[model samples]
Target chain A: MKIFVCVKPVPDTAAKIKVGGGASIDPAGVKFVLGPYDSRAASKAIALRDAAGDGSEVVAVAAGNPNKGESEARKRIKDVLALGADRGILIPDESYENRDPLAVAKALAAAIKNEGEFDLVFTGRQAVDDQAFSVGPMLATLLGVPCVTDVVGLEVDGKTATVKRAAEGRVEVLSVNLPCVITAQRDLAEEQYPKLKEILKANKKKIDTFSFEWPAPAYRVTELSPPPEPAAGKIVGEGPDAVPELVRLLREEAKALSF
Target chain B: MSEFRGVDFFLLDELLTDEELAMREAVRTFVDREFIDNRAIEEHHRAGTFPRDLPQKLGELGVLGPTLPDEYGCLGASSVAYGLMMQELERGDSGLRSFASVQGSLCMYPIYTFGSEEQKRHYLPKMARGELVACFGLTEPDHGSDPGGMETKAVRDGDGWVLNGSKMWITNGGIADIAIVWAKTEEDIRGFIVPTDAPGFSAPSIEGKFSLRASVTSELILQDVRVGPEALLPHSGGLKSPLMCLTQARYGIVWGVIGSMMAVFDEALRYTGSRTQFDRPLSSFQLVQRKLVMMHSELTKAQLIALRLGRLKDEGKMKHYHVSFGKRNNCKAAREVAKLGRELLGANGVCDEYQVMRHLMNIESVYTYEGTNEIHTLALGAHLTGHAAFRG
Candidate 1:
């Protein structure tokens, strides 16, 4: 089995993100980490490969800008490899950053094609930085494979896969055939922290780099603004006399109560 | 986990190779997950218990003598990579680093360097995988700074040796399955690989240690312990052999203490900024700023010294005195930095919640062990002045 996981290097969630001019996020003082959801995806891919035992290959790939120094991005990809991926592929093109999710999907699809055939492809449900959640589905569509989104549980047997996902606050199960796409949710598997030997070997594994022609972004950002600040809470009158006022406020001013 | 405030004022990351950075990052991630959990560490400390099966976990990580060759199940990585691992481990806690340092520099190093080919094949791989735990027994109840005067002796028997002595202040002593016991013979001092399960060998855990609370320290006793000829470390001839092992451990200490310094420095930085005094952040005060600045400078200087020493060690040009200089200077600086960090935390400093107090106590042990500061200073003094100062 050839398992593929797509990883993204995003600003660490703890970093203080600043909106620069032209609505771009400031990179200064921001520590970059492998996307959290992507980590789960990578972990799942490695687990499945390990479960399959002999002749299983896990290839970790990332599509990102080359000019910003691909080492940081490459480090994120290496992180997955250190977790047990067999090889790595990096598609380094400047346009990949802040581009359309469709462009990223297409580029990732091309890179996957360039790496020969893979029986399965795994991606995060969404990158925490953008929450776009479009890349995996779009990539699956481009590759003409069956796609499953927000997969909370997955089991693969030979040519078929049984998956469970959350649907309308309920559990939903679906079975799909081989050569399919999976966007992993947190419940897929707990990410394994890479150990020292794997980390050392990850440095020795050569990451094959490639570039893809990016499509025009479907949309562009006009401006950026911080979210609206929350309003201060107002106290209704004082003691038992306040009950009627609170009820009136809830029923009239807030409209939280009908009676 | 909070983002670590890595004080790399010298742009040192640029000096490291891409692989070195990757290695450092991975170790940092592991440390953050495993040892840096203050709540768990404090719990273990309060109970005076080491995390069970820690050696196996560390073995899986390949942190045991990572600089050794790949054939032994080690990483075969550069010395700098090994130093970074030590740095990150000590940043989590000094006791944690000491556990690894003993396993690698003390136990495995001598075996790899002095044991026969058959012995190396038998022990190195298993030790690296942490399948077998071991401890080094060089310091004795009578001899610490001066191991030449050690009272332990191994007398020749029919085709083997009978050893009788006691070793104190041995890290990992209680739980170790194998002990590299250095004892005097009629010809010379030699290292013997004695199984802790041998008939007369006993290791008892030393209780009530205020320092290295997160780690295990023990006393090893040997009463007429007999061992076969194969038990001897072939290439080890005299006191110089064990001192070489100490050099390896001391080199690691130079790097390890810097990690403790970095951790406390980062804590102080965060605490001062967030803690308010007189309606203003404590960081706003000039005196607080002075202390922080002092710690920051000392930590920065120590990091440079350790990194340079690491590079030199990788290059095979590092001298014993070089290690002494680094170990002595960095340990002293780390002690001062931890103190400044504690003072900056004020009342909260002494509490386990802040954790600076733990590093403060641990650094005191680091200062005394692996050749005390005075011993190292005298070594440096002897090197500069062609006089043997100890003779007087």
Candidate 2:
């Protein structure tokens, strides 16, 4: 089986993100890591390939420019390969900062198609940076393949794939045939930390790069700002007296209960 | 912003290869997931029996003697990479690092360095895989700093040797599958690979330690323990042989102390920020700022020194005095940093929940072992003054 894992490298969530004067975030001095969900997606692809035994190949695809030294894009592709991916394919695009979500998806779709036909394609539910959550579904739509999002568990038997996804207070299971796209959630798989030997091997694995013209973007980013701090909660009364207020607040302010 | 856990003050990470950084990250992640939140580690430290499964887990990571050849199930990486692994392991706990150090630097190293090809083929692969845990027995009951005076003797038998003596403060002792036993022979000091199950070879666990409680420290008793001629390390000779092993372990300790210091300082930074004093964060206080500054400076300096030492070791230019300088300086700095960190947390610091107290206690052992600070000072003193201070 031929598998493809789409990965993204984002600024480490734990690092201090400095918003620039132009409303763009400073990339300098910021540590980059594989997007949390993307790591799960890559891990899932590697797991599937391993379970399928010999002759199976897992390829990692990402959008990046080779001209930009130490760019997040190239690193993301390498990161997936380090996690046991057999090959890495990078779509060389320099306008990553200005490209909208749809344009990014188009480039990724082109890269996947350039790799010939893959039995399965995996992507993260969403990149941690920007939280766009659009690329996976958009790519699936472009490829004309069945797409499943928020997949926490997956099982494959021959050409049939069964996926368990998280819903609002419930789990929904879906079964699809061959040539499907899976957008992995956080719990899809426990990402494997590659040892030294694997890392060195991955470093030596040459990443094949492809160039493609960017399609007109469907959307544009306006302004980015940090989320507002939550308001401090108020306490009223004590003991039994507080219970009535709590119930009233839940019903009135929170709109959490009725009648 | 969340407190940054990756504290690379001098961009020392830039000095590392991609493989080295990746290896460190793997160990760092494993440690954070397994030991950082583990209440049982503290419990075991209190109870005196460390978890037996930890070495197996480390073995699965192929961290045991990772700098050794990959043909023996090791990583076949550079010495700097091995030092980084030790640093991360010690960041979790000193005992864990000690366990790896003894197994890798002390036991596996001598076999690979001095053993016959058959012995290396027999022990290195299994020991590297953690299938067969081993300990080094050089420090006898009376000889620690002066191992040359060790009384453990190996008398020539008809076709084997009869070993009679004891080793004290042996790490991984009671549970070790084999021991790299160094004994005085008719010619000179030689090492023997003694199986723990051999007749009259008993390793009893030592109890009630104020420091390094999580380690399986033991007293090894070899009463007429006998082994075949093949058990002997063919190439090893004199006290310098075991001292070479100590130099290797010390190289690791120099890096390991940085991890311990980093853990302490990271916790101290978090504690000072969140903890309030006089209606303001304790970090706002001038006195607290001074303490944090001191710790930050010391930790950064130690990190740079260890980085240079690791580079020197990988280049094969590392000398005994170099290890001494790094080990003695970093261990002492760690002691001071842990104490400051403990005080910064106030009453909460003494508790295991904070881990400063644990680091504080662990640093005491690190300061004494791998050559005490005073001994290192004298060694350096002799190097400079051209006068041996041992007699004085």
Candidate 3:
């Protein structure tokens, strides 16, 4: 089966992203890691095929340049391979510096659809950096397939899939047919621990690449600004009296109080 | 960034390629789901039981002995990837990572690096699959700092050898299926792989340990334990052989220490913000801010050093002294950071429920084990002075 995993490389969500003096995302000191949600998607795809009893080749395809030190993308690729994915397709994008999210998603969709056929597609619900939450749905629209967002459970049987999604404090079940895309969230499945054996196998797996025409821009970023840092607030009173004072501040100052 | 210049940090872009990340991601997902959240870890830590099914869980994840080369069921990810895996595991629990380190770095490494091909074939794959738990023994009660004074001796007994020695502080010792023990012959130090079921072999649990209590540390006594010539590690000679394994394990420590420090640092940072003090959150104080920044900078420096060393290790340019420097320096820095982190937590810090004191206790063992900080300093001094300092 040809399984495709589409992932985006973003600066580690936990990193202190510095907006430069020019208000641009600073590339100098930032470290990139695989989008955590996308990693869950890739992990699930690999697990699904493996449970089908081996001999399945899982391909993780991502768009990124390996030279600019966003090294997170390649590292993510290595992570997938180390977890038992058969191969990785790294499509380098020279235009990623200022690429728009929707445009980037469109380019990935076109490139993947053009190169080969896929039985199913997997993606994270959202990339942590931009939190655009647009790519997976957009890609599914491009492919003319149904997508279930925030999938916590998935089981594929021939041409149909049974999926579970948690919403409003309840588990919602949905059934979709073959070739559907899944946008996985963090709570989906537990990530596997890498053993020494698989880590070694990842080094030997074949990584093949092909360059294709990157689709022209379908969206553009007009501006970027840092979110305002939360201001430090003072604590009033001490010990037991502090609780009532905190409640007073929450009610009167921050206005987040319930009663 | 300047702190790490000229040091090859694991440049994921040009180095790891795409395939490696896929593999590592799989492992990370499994750990996060199965082990990190496993309440059983705390249960076992409390009950003093070996993580009974941890080997199976590891086998399911396919990560035990992960970087040992692909033919042996290893992932063969670059040293950097392996280091990251250690970081992730240590974040869950230091004991869990210790399980893998003893099995991989201390046990499997000696066999792979120094054993005969037959020995590797006989043990590597099973060990990799987590079918067998292996332990390494080098430290003895009387001679941790000076392994040269080790009293354990192996004597030739016709077609086989009779070994007599006692090894202590051995990780996975009591339950290990196989043990890679370092002992001395009349001429030099050597390594041997002895099956735990071998006659005259006994591994007794070392109880009442204040550190690494979650992980099993055992005492191994060999009374006329016999092994065929093939059991001997053919490549081992002098003190460098066992020390080489220490070199590998300590590099893992450089990363593992950071994982612990991050936990404490992150916790302390979060606590101060929520904690109330004089007319403000404890974090509002200038002194607290200073403590936080100091902890953060120390952790960051240690992280960069570990990452850079990981790259050098991948490039095969890592020197013994450089590794020692990272281990000694990072371990010392982490110990200091743990102390400050606990102090910043005030009354809640020392309690295990809050966990900073646990880190502080663990750092003491990390500082002394693998080779004490003083030992590393002496090793570094030897390089600087163009002289060996073991005797001096």
Q: Report fnat for all candidates as fractions from 0 to 1.
A: 0.92, 0.52, 0.60
Candidate 2: tens digits of C-alpha lDDT, residues A1-259: 8998888878888867877365457777888888889889889898899999999999888886566666677778877887889888888777677678788888888888877888999999998878889988999998889899999999999989988998755799988887989999989998676655677678888788878898766666667776678889888878997998899988788878665
- Chain A TM-score, cand. 3: 0.82
What does candidate 2's lDDT look like per residue over B1-392, in tens digits?
A: 22328578888888888678778887887777667755666777777778788878888777899888878778788888898899898888899999999999999999999999999889998888788999999988888888889999999999899999999999899989999999999999999999999999999988888899889899999999989999899999998999999999999999898889888999999999999879999999999999999999999999888888888888889888898899889999999999999999999998887778998999898999889999899888888899979754
Candidates sorted on TM-score, descending: 2, 1, 3
Accuracy of chain B in candidate 2 (TM-score): 0.97
Q: How well is each residue in A1-259 modelled by candidate 1, as lDDT tens digits?
A: 9999998888888778887486568777777888888999998898899899999989988887767854566888888888879989888767655587888889889999887877899999999988899999999999999999999999999899999986544779999998999999988898578877887778778789877877778886667776677889989889999999899988788878756
i-RMS, each model, one decimal: 1.8, 2.2, 6.7
Whichever of 1 and 2 has more DockQ, that candidate is 1
- Compute the lDDT of residue B163 as modeled in candidate 1: 99
Q: Candidate 1's residue-wise lDDT over B20-59, tens digit each?
A: 7777777777777776654667777667788777788789
Superior candidate under lDDT, 1 versus 2: 1
For model 1, the local distance difference test gives 0.88
> Cα lDDT of all candidates, in order?
0.88, 0.87, 0.77
The worst-scoring run of ten residues by lDDT in candidate 2 chain B lies at B1-10
Give me the displacement of residue B356 in model 1, in angstroms.
0.8
Instruction: Identify the runs in model 2 with alpha carbons over 4 angstroms from their true place.
Output: A234-259, B1-4, B38-40
